[model samples]
Target: MAAAFLSRPVYPGLALVPQARRHIFALEGAGAGALTDLAPDAGALTRSDILYLPRDPDGAAQAVALAALGAASLWQAPDLAALLSRLAGLLDGARMGTRLYAAGSEGFIGQVLVVAEAAGIDPLSVATEHRGNRARRVQCVHCKTVAEEVTTQPCACPGCGLTLFVRDHYSRRLGAFQGVCIDAEEPGSAPAAEEAFR
Candidate 1:
């Protein structure tokens, strides 16, 4: 009976994440010094300049040691619209050698990546540490709607009223998984909704 609540025709193989190798500065959110395999001096990372998600101070702990170092900490619970406005000013005059480090919820890292990428910062120079719930950002191809923190597989599109089956494929351009109509073959036919995507 539990399966009755879950979506039918589950695309177990459809969820394909991007293949790009990311530079993992921290996965445990333990900060820079505690990063295994790599040990960068706080002074060096500071003098070279850095940006971090302020909510996960584990990485920021070392950056705080140097008072005169150029370090920018993003608020833990920041308003992306507002934070991006401020990040723009910083990126406008961003000099070479400045590194970006983010350690927080997946949403935060993903959103910050959008800004950093827009600023022309290479992904190689940035590090991301994902924390918190394992959710995803999904965008509907039909209506061009973005769904945030989605925790289900086959779900209804909040924008166009279409049932979408999320693919594992991730698009860097859209910053979300591609959600296509799973019942497109039969038009109105669809599987049961999953109580939770996780």
Candidate 2:
């Protein structure tokens, strides 16, 4: 269906941990009862970064729950834009041993992967869980400006003001889907627009 084509990009390299180490904590083992004594809003990881979007109640709950379950260190991001901004500073002095746990909508998860890749964090040290669907990241092909969680096609490119048609092709490197000007060949002409993307 059209929805399948409108899905977000998948970066295989960013998602997998090719080298699994025994010494490193297995994310699967971080069960609910692991570190219950700890507080939900404890703080940022002493040796890592626990990033989540505060706007997503589910993500916020998961972030706090993870902290309570021994993820003890945490940093709550007000939003994705703010987290992307602070991540640079967080990684500047971070050690190779530092880990990252991310949970949120696909758009948020994807962008987190972008930041993680940029930070040079090993895939082995990262874990992600999807909290929701129905959101997507749309990148402006003309300008590379990414519009987060765009819910409609033929929408105006946030960066260049072009009417973008969300294409099936997705670019993992960009963490967004391919978008082309619907009226590129013929100005003022376009396909019938849908109500919106869920």
Q: What is the C-alpha lDDT of each candidate?
A: 0.53, 0.55
RMSD of 1: 9.3
TM-score, structure 1 vs. true: 0.63
lDDT of 1: 0.53
Off by over 4 Å in 1: 1-77, 195-197
TM-score of each: 0.63, 0.63
Angstrom error at residue 107, model 1 = 3.8
Residues 8-73, model 1: lDDT tens digits: 211111111123221222122333332322334444333333333333435456435322333223
* Model 2 Cα shift for residue 53 (angstroms): 1.6
Tell me the tens digit of each residue's lDDT in model 2 across 1-198.
Answer: 554664444322223232321111112112211222222232322223344444533444555665554443445656557777676566655654455555545566566567777878754355655444555688888998888878787777889988999876766567677778999899889876674657
Collision count of model 1: 7
C-alpha lDDT (0 to 100) for residue 129 of candidate 2? 55
The 10-residue segment of model 1 with minimum total lDDT is 8-17
Error of 2 at 116 (Å): 1.9
